[model samples]
Structures are given as C-alpha cells and as structure tokens.
Target: MGGNLSAQDEPASKRVAAALRGRIEKGELAAGSKLPSEREIASEYEIARTTASAAIRLLEQEGLVLRQHGRGNFVRETSPLIRLGGDRYSRKYRGGPTPFRRECERAGLTPRVEVLAAEQARPPIEIAQRLGVDSFTESVLQRSNLYFADDEPVQVVNTYIPWAVAEGTPLVERKQTGKDGIYGRLEDCGHIMTTIREEVTARMPDHREREMLALPGGTPVLQVIHTSIDQNQSPFEVTRFVLRADRNGLLYQLAVD
Candidate 1:
C-alpha cells in the first residue's frame, strides 16, 4: 500500500482501512493477495499495532478481507455465489443441477454437496412451533446438507419434515430424494407447495457452525429460515440455512405489490 503520510478528517484506523480498501477495489491488491502485517502497517503509518489490527478487522467485517488461521490476512475472494431467492425452487429449474450447483457452475466454480446426517431428531422449541409438533418429545426427520464451492464449505442446510410425512419415503435417505429435489418428493406426498415464507437474520455462529464452515473468528453467519406451505395452508416443511456472511449473498426478486 502506497499513499502520502498525512492526517485526514477520520480517525487513523479508519484512514488506514480506507487506503487499503481503495486499492482492493481498484484491483491493485488482487484477490487472494496477502496483506501486509499489522506491524508493518503500524511502522508505515506511525500507529500502534492495535490500530493496524483494528483497520484490518474493519475490512474483514465488510467482507473485503479474509483471515486464515496459521496464515495472514488476504483479500477476500472476489466472486461470490448468490442465492436466487424463491426462484431457486421454480419447477422450471428441475431435472438438472440443484440451485446451488447451478450457481457454482455459472460462476465457473465446482460445486459439491455432502449429506452430513439423515435421522429423526427432536425439534427445538422454536423449530417445534414452526413444524406444529409437540415440543415435549416429538421428533422430526432432519436431512443436513453441507454445500461447497471449489471444495470450500459455504453453507449448511437442515431440512425438517414431519415423521408422519417422511416415514416411508425417500425423504429419509441421505442422498437427494429426486432430481427435482425435496419439493418434488414433498408434492408426491400431497404436500404441494403453494407459498414460501423466508426470513433472513444475521448473528455469530456457534462453535459447530464456525468449524463446519471454516469461518474466521468474529465473522457472522446469515440464518435464513424457510417455511413451505401446502394447498391446505399447512406448513409442511421448514429448512434452516446457515450461510457464510463473507462468501454468500441472497437476492430476492419480488413483484411490486
């Protein structure tokens, strides 16, 4: 990073971060480029190492830099795989790659999914309410999937189906129930999807999620909860998507009502 040594209206940390951020946007510091150490930045700007570290932290929070354990900080990957919102479930997109795989291929990246677990588990109180199950001890069939792009884990999707609906179907299988994906098997079981309700929130990840997604310390995750309703106005399926805030984005295209 090269810039004149001078004071600005902002604080020293913000000023340093802005300088580095500008170069990153201009491609002067290309993707995956290793950033200078905090000590180096401190020496250059005549600021404390803490200030330098704070500046780097700012960039990381903005999803412009990546912090890897045992390694140094670097520019974040430029290309991110985007979720096509509700359109991903369109029946027209069936018979080929799932929405996730298609997004990776469209970005010229390889996509892979690992079925982590398929078992009946008792739903949490929050989940139980959404599934309309008894929170006391009722169980729901859960299929957990870990999606990756270029071999890096990006998100974990956990889909829950009532045991009454998944008891004897492929829904209990570890692999995809069908090329059309879970919704098809859902429709087969008479749970025809009519409306989808999605809610997105952001919060720090738990230890398991942090380790699963290989996320850095202090990074947050986007939690997208989806509820699929049937023709009878009953919520049949609920999926919780934990997406890496740094590597993923959600795009929603809705009609102007």
Candidate 2:
C-alpha cells in the first residue's frame, strides 16, 4: 500500500517512528509486546517497507524497542527511577545502607553492587589537584563500582582517596564497607564530613561506557564529579559517577538565603 506524503513535510520514516513512539509511551504497546512486522507497518502506514524498517531502527536507537535477530521488535521495559540529592549524604543515612541501595529500596527495587576494583593507583591530574596532592604522588586509592537496579546496570562510580587517609583502613580493601560506606569509615578515622561539591554534565556515552551500561545508541549519560570535604575544609575524596540518563532524576534542595 502507498499513500501521498505531500501534506507532511517531515520524512516518511520519521513520521512513522513518531507514531509508533507515541503508542509506546502511551502504554498502548506494553513492555515486551511485539511490534508490527515491517510488512505490516508498511501496509498500515502506506509507506515503503524499507522506510518502515528504518522507523523501527529509529525506535531501537531511542531505547524504546528491542529487535532480536529472529524474534522481531518488542517494546522495552522501563527502568527504575533514581533520585540523587543532598539528603543522601546525611549522617543518618551514613554507615547504614549505601545511598544507592537505600534509594533503590525506597523505590521498591532490588539494588546490587559489583566491586570492580579497589586498590592503590596513581590519581588523575584533576583528582590529584582536587585532593591537594602533587602530580607525582603515587598515594591514591581507587575504588571502582558498578551499581545495578533490578539486575539492570544503572551507574558506574570511581572514587579516589588520598593514601594518607585510606592507608590503614578498609578503604584499601575490595570488600564491602559494611553498613557504613567510605564516608562512615572516614568519620571513624577522625575526618568528619562537612560538605560536598558536585559538578554535573551530560554527553553521549563513550564506547566503553556504552558496553558497560548496555546503553542504546543515541542515549546520553550524566557525569557527576563529587568532592567530599571534611570538617577541616580539606577535600578527602573525589568521585566520578556515570549515571544512565534515562534512569535517574537529580534533585537539589537549595536553601533560600
């Protein structure tokens, strides 16, 4: 079947994709529901079969549909929403469940963490500068972590700590930090946290990140650089968190001065 496209200036593929996307977002196409076949879509939309295929590809890139080699296209399941805010750093939450775990629990989702690495490593120039260490210093501890919500990878975190601060503590181990996270352990070491500084940016994920997070093409990620400061006004930790843009919402509660 064919139809005239003179009325709409947009490309045929885009129009078809838009229509299908709306259906998916409106829940007309439930998660895991199969999409119309290329032939069916082409006949229904009165577009070329190739154009219908391209439309499905577009939805795949947008992470709204998954196309298996033999199983045909299907609507993708939604991910849990994570809210990142200042309250996660409160002392009350520290040394209990990890902030990530707590957030997932609050959302009624299972939270899982895989400790990728925890070892002493040379810090990057930016991290070294933030920690007030010389460029040549080899005394930094790095902790790399992967967080999953409901078994879906959602975020990657890399935290750097000055060797002087983490040398004699569990921070140097690759084991769980118990109820208290790194911040709690630091508190036990006489470094009381006072403030946190965060810088947020967004960009498309690099190849490595895309593979690690199993992200779809055209999906962007949120990069958050966090600096933890102690009561002495000294920066004790620098953490880089890469969050799946589709799965997280950041909230900042600012005081009106």
How close to the true structure is residue 163 of candidate 2, measured as C-alpha lDDT? 87
Residue lDDT tens for model 2, 1-257: 67765638788999999999999889899998999999999999999999999999999888788887798988877655666577878887754787888889888889999999999888999889899976686779999999999998999899998888899898888977876788878888888879999999998999989999988666789999999999889999999999998777688886787
* RMSD versus native structure for model 2: 3.6
Per-residue lDDT of model 1, residues 18-42, tens digit only? 9999999999989999999999989
Q: Give the Cα RMSD of candidate 1.
A: 4.7
Cα RMSD of all models vs. native, in order, equals 4.7, 3.6
The TM-score that candidate 2 achieves is 0.90
- The C-alpha lDDT values of all candidates are 0.87, 0.87
Q: Which has the greatest lDDT? A: 1
**Model 2: per-residue Cα lDDT at residue 91:** 80
Flag clash pairs in model 1. Answer: none
Worst 10 residues of 1 by lDDT: 1-10
